[model samples]
Target: MLPDALRSRLALARRSLLPCRGCLGPVGEGAEAGLCGRCWGGLLPLPEGRCPRCALVHAEADCPEATAWDCGDALWDYHGGRPPLGALLLPGIKQGEAGWRKALLGRVLRGPLPDWAAEVDCVTAAPSAWPHRLLRGFDLSAEAARLVAGRLDRPFTPLLAKGWLRGRQASRTESQRRRLPKRAIGLRRGAAPRGLILLVDDVWTTGTTLLRCAQALRAGGADEVRVLTLFRAL
Candidate 1:
């Protein structure tokens, strides 16, 4: 255990390191996490007038199959910026940054929550590879779920687990992504999270991961599943 004086000094150092929570930018007096105003403005709420199911723009008429298994509701289209909206998430998922994680969570709160997320009895996250988690010292998806659940005042869960480890998905093409084994995700034995489950993750790419996550939830006795991602790949 750390000595009291040393622990207190370390705590003060950590407090000094955290940025304002609002903007994920710079520190300010009395600011929550050193977030500055300009970075705060970068957060984009989920736009109005999107398909209820997939959150894609559809004819004013809803997609005929909107109700099938539910789909993703994202905050921003991924094409506006050169690297796109979800760019921040890719690095954080592959790398690690507490500040980026906090900003991503803040983005989720600013967006429209899918009915499933709003009504889900509990929230869970897609599990990262154990080796990756060990290297990072934290699971990005779980961190995202915790932040989101805190914002929504709902329960957060870390029940899901990866069934197989795989290479990073960031550089892989959609076709390459499809080739990933079906057993990439699974639920822990006898630890199902029932009811509507809100699955949280940093990014939605090719939709395969989210779909697989939904399947895992369903297998775990989840009656329904909805996704809340920081950004969607265009």
Candidate 2:
């Protein structure tokens, strides 16, 4: 049998020969990177007109309701009723399509960041539920936070630790979701850091989870908390 290092190198070489996952076009010189320039450009110019505080689409110039986080941003608006192409790709990501997932996330990270992000002292993620992590085999939010931190040249910290809950928030009714205990998420014993923090998450549904995370960060002594999600469910 091939040595472990040789097998790993061969696997990477095979992946390098694959086409771009987004456009299914020839990866050419960028094969190792998983995306071609054209396909990467297609993901750009993310839909705008979202409330910077809640990341919700505001028909008016401002959000009517107040948001718990100091500010927020999202890559796409997920119309939950019909869903968008981005939403459709989310399931594939959670299913462990690493190439497509990395390409999509790379596009987002390479794009312009919010002005407030410049002031961010650290980056962290809203931890995934234990059951979900066990089933998905990866932490989507944590990966996103790491990518964002690397892109922004900020420190990445796992500030929040998730505790198992009775049911998945996605499977619960809006009212039931709202009733979820805030303590479902807690601050990591020594992970808290001072100053502005950018909390990353894969999606925003009712904002309850992010609120709980922000509360935990505050309780742990974060001066300011902001959220950055890949998509917003509207």
TM-score of each: 0.71, 0.75
Per-residue lDDT tens digits for candidate 1, residues 214-233, read 88788778898888776665
- The local distance difference test score of model 2 is 0.76
Q: Which stretch of 10 consecutive residues in model 1 shows the poorest summed lDDT? A: 80-89
Per-residue alpha-carbon lDDT of candidate 2 for residues 1-234, written as tens digits (9 for 90 to 100): 999999999997887678766567666654434656554444333357656787656677667754667588776655331224455557877777776777767767676777888789999999887778888788888988898899889999999987885667777999998898877889877775578999999888788899889888888898989988877766
Pairs of residues clashing in candidate 1: 19-33, 19-34, 20-33, 20-34, 20-35, 21-33, 26-34, 27-34
Which candidate tops lDDT? 2
Q: Cα deviation of 141 in candidate 1 (Å)?
A: 1.8
Query: Candidate 2 regions off by >4 Å?
Result: 1-47, 59-62, 79-83
Give residue 23's lDDT in candidate 1 (0 to 100): 39
Query: Candidate 1: what lDDT?
Result: 0.67
Candidate 2 clashes between residue pairs 3 or more apart in a chain or in different chains: none
TM-score of 2: 0.75
The reply for model 1, stretches above 4 Å from the true place, is 1-40, 59-68, 80-85, 106-116
